[model samples]
Target: MKITVILCYAMFLGACLSFLGGCASGKSSASRVEVTPFSCVLAPDTNGSVCVDVVFRVPSQYLSRRSRLIIVPQLLLDGKLSEELTPLVVDAPIYAKKMYRRKVVQNYQDPYDAYTGKVEGVSGGLELPYRETLTIPLGVHTGCVQAIVTEDGCGGCTGLDTVEVASVRNLASLIQDTFELVRMEPTFHEGKVEVLLQFLINRHEIRSDLGNNRSQLKKLAGSLRPILADTLTRVGDFRIYGMASADGSRAFNTTLARKRAESLREWLLKELDIHPELYTRMVVDSRPEGWLPVYQAMVDDGHPDSLFVGQILRRYPGSDDDVQEQYIRRLSCWKDICSRYLQKDRKIECAYTYTSYESVLATDGMWIPFPIKQMEANNQAILCLRRGQFEKAVDLLKDFVHYTPATMNTLAVGHFRKGDVKSAEKLLRKVKLPEAFRNLGVLMALQGKWYEAYRFLKGSGSLNEAVVALILSYNEEAEAIMAELSDQSPLAEYVRALVTSRLGDDVAFEVHLKNACQLDELRLRAAGEPDFEKYREDKIFREIVK
Candidate 1:
């Protein structure tokens, strides 16, 4: 009974083989299929898509005598199928004959038999070669190419089987990461304050009770207090000018004016405690008041002789103060003018110029005045930029003429962060600073110009530079940069994780990713990051993301 069963089994196997058009002597092996460009990378192209060159080789006798081989190429993103290329089909003699009979003689069509290229009459030793360039839309961060092979037996004698023939991994994609924010250096600003003190006629000394002298000196001192209180401020150009009324002789008035200026200068030196060096730098001058002030005061007061005084002054424009004063004394309202406005010009005026070194507080995304006080226009615009107020910053900077290289860089950065790439590039082109180059690199990266970004970010020594390096597959350089980076923030840790993963350091990648996932934002980013797709099912990665 056992011998009969064995004989029956042998006959059935032989019949099956014969019905399948006779199996080849050589065994079918997936190793016979070859794919070129072992490391599949979807690089960005100028045509708005990522394209790759693909070549497939099937050695002789790779297909069975009565079988059909269908090869489909697919692009996988994050381990999920993204795009599929046209299939390449090859059929043995019997299978090709059957397909031809079904389609032509029986007038039947099979939708499942769709293919781009086909090879019929394999003859048990035919070799097949397929080569083509495949394309897909850009912006995929990570992806790989895989070739799937499907085998269909002749007349159902053998069951269908599918297998992965070839694949390439470590596809690169654009990285979105934090950029550098440059801090502005301290700037120099100048301010001036003046105080006018009226003096009694012909008098050289100051009378505190006269006119508004006491109040004016007090106000001037108050203004000086704040300027002196700040160590960053330096006061200089201490100048005192004395002008006498037109009532006295030119010689007498000039001497009186000089004495009046000296008296005020001495008072300031004593009261303000002016340093000896500053005192030496002080300037004192004297002048006799011409008839202009008298004429102006009369016209303003609507005096009857105002026009006459103006006529005389204009007629003798080149005359000295004495000649002009003599002509002005003849006016009918001269006395009135002396009482009202002449006394105004008979005064000692003190003026000083100061320079202040100003700085601001700069954070990641916001800037504040260092002392929490009102800032100048330029500094205010910087604050606006750091706060993401792009329009306001542009408005403030557009018409401003005194832009430093640093301020120009700030303006460019504002435009870049606001999605105005053209404007940002135009402005950055004019700025010659390392910060500007760094910003340009980031802009290039954002626009899918990885090579340009790599060039611009080279030697920047910033995390942004390292990220660009990683995206360009400069693994060793990226690793070296990460080691040099001093940033310990979650974003920095996340970038470190990316670098380690690309370098095949799985343990370090997990550690860095865990550290970065502490932040909810980073965790969410990692959850969808294609670079971390392989780790999505990892126990520790799942826990970290969850």
Candidate 2:
């Protein structure tokens, strides 16, 4: 009995020793965590977030069958963790941002877009070779880390790494941040052409016509053709305006101006058949030419309607104010010469003839082509897209997109024009577009795409664009525009009210239109508006619109 009892006790002691040894020699530390293709975050925004885009590179050192990702993003200020955080998911380029510049993001490139981040599942496993994007809004000073593989009970990802964080933010660094890959802004601006023609100017002086100009022009136009085509595929109304330098005598300057306009026009006709630069800031009408009080006021302010008109008549550049008669006489003499040539249908080179806006419109304007050759090379990419050539279109479009990020309508237009309307619509639905889309709404309406017009218009700016689009897109004319008008702001409210009343919900429109006429600005725009033709003829409409 004693021997049996001793044997039992020895067996129990052996079992306890085995259990203690197992606990002492644990393998948790040796439990390796390998995250490959991982991107390290050097800086995070004020929102306390940084995106992690590491791929789960299979460990060659050890089989990763039992391993998980161990992310160690640092804390910003207060004690915080990225465990509960979620970043914005997208497919575009990333931009790093601070709190101050978001207000003027359009003018400034989207700093967030310049940034690139990756998105992965939350403590969940994803199939290999997956692509994802995560937008991590910054808090004061924290970075974010997400695991693609599940680690329900693992403590490897619990704390931050002990390392100093370095950050840079100056103009140069900011520029680098904005265009890390490349800049597409020039894909639309003429800056590309200017850059290619860098040899045309001797530092700042325009050289006496260079011979390399032809070679440069050909390369530039050809290189930019696909670019321009893509740009135009994304825009509307190639408005073009030409300006002359402040130099030369009235006649010489006038002739030079005409030549410049003609030259530009010829270039457009030769290259871009439909693409054109938009013209801006044309001097239009003002209150009637003469009122004694207003006239005197103008004269006192160094401007008189007659004098202003006369200066224009004399073909005088506004740069000089002294010796009006001397300039006028020279203009008169030059004008007579130009008139004779005009009467005989004769031609005179630039640097000889004096001209006016009216005169130019009658002659040189006729020869000015619609799309300059320089412009055509940049536009006309829709040919392939409209023919259902998506891969070709996407290739060209992507290159274009890499250059100009704001031209979202390029994809939309290309897809729509290509008979892939569903794809076009779907593509636009993916991102929150800028208010620039307002212009696209009007453009669509101009193209007779009423459905797209309505869609784009309805999705434009909050107050102003919405009101304008409502009136413009409404079935009727002035009714809808009139309805939104208020007496407080005649120009804004009344125009809207008129449109609303004439075209949209009449009851709501007429009530507002009448209120608009009670204000001054509405009365002013109505007097000049051609859209009010029918309104002006109807006493009721006229009374309300006016």
Candidate 3:
């Protein structure tokens, strides 16, 4: 009986030792917890939450009486961890020496007690297959969900076991500027042809003594051929204001003026082979004796008689037809006046408006040629600029001089588009053109000079200016400017949508956003814009951006 008691005690002792050893060696740290492949999904629930499900497997031996499982979850966006979600705590079975003999867990409390304490569970040979569903708000940018599990068991603990839950994405820009229309107008050339014809005294007939007079008439008539051939021409009256010399009687001189003008018109028509009907409408009028020419000639001759001539003209001022000439012919300067000036008084002056066409072939696009050859380079550069060849445009304009305000403005724009804002601003200071103001405003807005940008952009009526206003939170200004945009460009409307969204005008926002997406034709760009962040959870916003 004594021997049997001793053997039974030893057996009990040995069994207790074996049980304690098993608990101490509880599945090596590597096999403690195993999580299956899981990932965060982009499926947004009706509650504006993104759902992610994960499965964890805890081996039977890993659940010791003193051990607990703590899971810390975090969302990583663009490789950065999110701090919004709370960590999860799940306690496991603790197999104490006395509790092992009972074969049942005691004091099993829910791990979510919100306190730091140990919980108990049944000490069974069954493995734990756990599944959990985590809901994260859709507002968070979650590229991946990470789960870090650590066992709070024996004196020493297992290092962190990390599981990555990658998120799935199932969802799917004009630098707008104002352009002026190019217009081409026909070129016009204007000139006058004057003819001085001589006639025999008191006679309306042409004289042989006249030198080169016929040749002069022929030259004048021939010049009209080229003018008449122009696409557009306006022929003025062929005027012949005839005058008489001071020696002739008033009545005879008048008759001679009229007859001489008529004879000259007839001769021109016959000699030039022009229609007589056209000459009939020509102007032929008689004027008083041409005394002004005689006075002017005496003054121009610088003769000693000029002082006496001026005194005589000023002393005797009469409106009579030949009074002045009558007195002048009696003076010593009379010969100088008649010989130099009276001969020039008998003349015909002809003038007409002529418009010609010049064809300028553009390289491509809607570029027009510059009016002057010096600016041809600028024209070509503008063409290149319109085609988005900024570097080529810059190269073409590199050596260009004679910069007009328009050319400077275009070159500045090219430089701005190339990210050379300093150079662009330098050129802009030379001109206060509206385009220059708008470009400067755009640059200022990019540099975060909001107030300065507003100052420059105000009243510009440019779509880019409106965009800057919207970005700077100048709602009233943005709305006012955007309303004036006739093109309703996608970028402009998109900015309007942002303004409306801020004002809580959902209907208008939706309307504008829809139009923007339609015109722009790409939803992804809208998705990346920060202005729409608040609407990320809205179904309409999602649909449009997607």
What's the number of clashes in each of the models? 0, 70, 4
Q: Model 1: which ten-residue window has the lowest total lDDT?
A: 165-174
Candidate with better lDDT, 2 vs 3: 3
lDDT of 2 by residue, 77-171 (tens): 32234333222222111111221254466465533343323323222333233233333343122233433222211222221222222121110
On residues 321-380, what C-alpha lDDT tens digit does candidate 1 reach at each position? 788777777777777766776655355666677766564333222344342223345577
- Model 2 local distance difference test score: 0.36
User: Following a full C-alpha superposition, what root-mean-square deviation does model 3 have from the true structure?
Assistant: 19.4
lDDT of 1: 0.67
lDDT of each: 0.67, 0.36, 0.60
- For every model shown, what is its TM-score relative to the native structure? 0.53, 0.19, 0.38
Could you tell me how far off, in angstroms, the CA of residue 129 lies in candidate 1 after the best superposition?
Answer: 7.1
Per-residue alpha-carbon lDDT of candidate 3 for residues 383-475, written as tens digits (9 for 90 to 100):
887898989877765554445555666777778768787997787767556766777776665555657767887887777666666645677
Predicted structure with the largest lDDT when compared to the true one: 1
